[model samples]
Target: MNTAAYFAQIYREPDPFQYRQRWYEARKRALTLACLPRQRYRNAWELGCSNGVLSAALAERCDALLGTDLSAAALADAASSTAAFANVRFEQAHHPQDWPTGQFDLIVVSEVGYYLSAPDLSEMATRLRTSLADDGLLLACHWVHPFAEALSSAAEVHEALAGGLVEAFTYRDADLVMQGWGVSPTSVAACEGLR
Candidate 1:
């Protein structure tokens, strides 16, 4: 099945991925938010924003945020879930193809890269290299376990995205890998001139 159709069917349940009820998801959200080096971003984009759970949290820190999903159902849920946040909006996009134009200070790809084939993953990296702001941070989080839907493994996904970028931080667990990459990677303490 194509990614869009697959997601649309699953989203018929309106939270099929259980963003609100799943412990793993809750923990992942917390970890992703905490790992961000900056407290505020001028603009941010979240690819494959399942239900806007993360986007809602991100809205608190970004002047503007865009969340893209493959399915209208998911986007609708995302829009509703994030209705209170004026800075947040949901759009439907086909990934690497429908990617938004203009540079972003923050671009997050969470659990979405593995769905693309190796070539497409490479293309995504290329886009990230150019679409990202010079001082931008690209954060990626993915599941470590292999699944039937995965076109690439977590290692391949992260490796593909990290190309030509500097790794700022990384967190690994038995089930997931979360990391951030950027230009001129620096330490938080260093950003604060502690060193």
Candidate 2:
């Protein structure tokens, strides 16, 4: 099955990944948010936003946020989930191919990279670097264990996405791996003039 169909099938369950209920999911989201180097972003885009659980949280920190997913069902759920957020918008997009035209100060790739083939991931990395604002940041998080549907390992996905970007930080556990990348190599303390 293709990625869209696979996701569409699973999304029929509304909260297929239990992103809203699982403690692991909540903790991961919190960690992702806390790891961000800045308190606010002018513009942000979340690739494969799923049901907008994380998108809504991100909306709180961004002036404008765009969430994209390949599944219409997922987008519908995302819109409903983030209905109160005027700064958030949802769209249907197949990454690296249906990419948006503008740059974003924050681009999030979460739980979606492993679905792409190697070539697609490479193209995505290149596009991500170019689409990022000069001082922008890129964050990617994914499951570490092998899964039947995943086309690539989490390591491969992160490596491809890390191309042309400086490592910011990484968090890993048995279940997941999360990393942040950006143009500058500075730490949060350095950015805050504490270093």
Tens digits of per-residue lDDT for model 1 on 1-195? 498778878888978988999999999999999999998999999999988899999999999999998989888888988899999988899878887888999999998999998888899889987989988999999999999999999999999989889998999999999989997775889878899
Q: Residue pairs in steric clash, candidate 1?
A: none
Please report, in order, the local distance difference test score of every candidate based on alpha carbons: 0.91, 0.92
Indicate the worst ten consecutive residues by lDDT in candidate 1: 1-10
Q: Give the TM-score (vs. native) of candidate 1.
A: 0.97
- Of candidate 2, the 10-residue stretch with the lowest lDDT total is 183-192
Task: Residues 84-145, candidate 2: write the lDDT tens digits.
Answer: 99999988999878989899999999998989899998999899999999889999999999
How many clashes in each structure? 0, 0
